[model samples]
Target: MAQPTAAESWSGGNEPMKAEYGKLMMWFFLVSDALTFTGFLTAYGFMRFGHEATWPIAEDVFTHFPGIEGDQPLLYVAFMTFVLIMSSVTMVIAVNAGHQLKKTAVAWWMIATIVGGFIFVGSQAWEWYHFIIGDKGGIELADGRVLKVAEAQTGEVLSLSQLVDGEAGHASNHLEKFSTGEVKTAFEANEGLVLQSPGKGHAQLTRTESLRLMQNAQVVQGANMKHNEYGQGQFANFFFFITGFHGFHVFSGVIFNIIIFYNVLLGTYERRKSYLMVEKVGLYWHFVDLVWVFVFTFFYLV
Candidate 1:
């Protein structure tokens, strides 16, 4: 091959940019990944805005968790968000160490990043557990009403009549029992309860609760706990599909990081005299984190 002249080197280089071709490819991949995330987020916004009246308020919907009593709105997700963000920081440190050719430093940061990723996944699983299996679901009634039990000063869920549809000298109506067994019962039937707002209100029960209510004579005879009190069926569907897909990407990224971490320990990149592998995987990992940020903001925050 012919050597390039100094003029060619300064102008249109016979050489590539300071970054290798692999790094450039990683950039392209990240841009495309960003667009994919944007599409998902835009679709979410469109659907949510499209049904603003009926959409769930994220905080009210996700307030409680197992083993911890009382309202802790968005608590689980907030922890997951912090974990993922810290993992991103560790990943940056690893990338910096790669640039400095410090293999052990890179491995240390990568291990920390992996630990953060695992913690994030664990948090997500716990959140899902609360969502899928641990909520105390409830019901609605006719005459534009719904009933939830509430905690009275005595430490018990007050009858619907006590909370909103107060019987005497009350501004707002306390929750009223659907006379003659009209409202469906919740899971455990006696788990601690709180009355969510009416059908027009934003709280939601899970699929199981929805189905259970559907089968009940009260709801079947005619109560409004029908298809989706928490969110539209389409909304729930998209939420699961999009978020679950993004989570799978995070899982894959963790695996990729593990492989790269092993290679770094084995001196593979050192033998090549290039740290491009670490850099490339780092780009992918950051893309995963970026997607989660949008997911957290759009789905849980706003």
Candidate 2:
């Protein structure tokens, strides 16, 4: 019996795909993941708009970089976004190299993508630390309203320790929790720190108003499942859950890329004379990057 000709094989099978099982499976996974993210984001949108009065501002919540500081809002997150997008570009280059069987170029491009993933993942970790530990510590009132001290002259937000005389540690360290009486005393003694009130503007508190508002205040550190320096607890919950979920995906992609990079180093694809695996992985890498664009817009830019 004679085998089918090359032309016949190329033109047949479900129209084109001869054995693109991996690509098909990857698409299925991406579609399912998209649905999950859509549901979560929808819930977030509803909760956010429902309680618009108490929702935290994205810019203020995620404003930290590393050594360099001073209220450089959204700078670090923007860099993370850029790194992730560049990684997707490198993935495209890697897939192209794989198609051409340029083993060296493929390996190098994969390495670049891996490095970008690391930077993104690490940036996410730092963000989590800052968020969980909080920056400007606030005082929670009886009605669940959180109020932070701001400079009356410069409008600079001050942590509770600054206004309240507590044996506080560094912003990154465990805070020395202050009582309501202490906070009230501090505010009464120092006429510098003002109050941050919503709706009336971020800095719309008189010296006397600030002193009166601290009548029933309790110290609150950064943010957690229960409390947040920003606003409502839901804000912190959603931030942690949504961003943490995306971070896990990026981490998984890093591991997958590492496995493929290891295979590239060992000449596995070269021996097989096919770069199909690299192309499949590239599809996943691009999908991850695409999802992040939406997340960034929804959470940060919006």
Query: What is candidate 2's CA lDDT for residue 72?
Result: 75
In order, the Cα lDDT scores of the candidates are: 0.63, 0.81
Write down the worst ten-residue block by lDDT for model 1: 217-226
lDDT (Cα, tens digit) per residue for candidate 2, span 1-302? 35668897677664344458888889889999999888878888898888776677788767667776456788988999999999999999999999999999999999999999999999999888888877767778778877667778887666666566443334532346666677677778776777775312464578786676677677787788888878867888888899999999999999999999999999999999998889888888898898899889898878
Candidate 1, residues 125-229: lDDT per residue as tens digits? 666544543232334334323333443223332332332233421111212233324233432353444343322343444445444443432221111223333
Clashing pairs in 1: 148-195, 160-175, 161-175, 164-173, 164-174, 165-173, 165-174, 165-175, 166-174, 204-230
Tell me how candidate 2 scores on lDDT: 0.81
| Candidates' RMSD to native | 8.9, 4.5
Q: Who wins the TM-score comparison?
A: 2
Would you list the clashing residue pairs of candidate 2?
Answer: 134-222
- Listed in order, each prediction's TM-score against the native is 0.70, 0.85
Q: Which lDDT value does model 1 have at 297?
A: 85
| Top model number, lDDT | 2
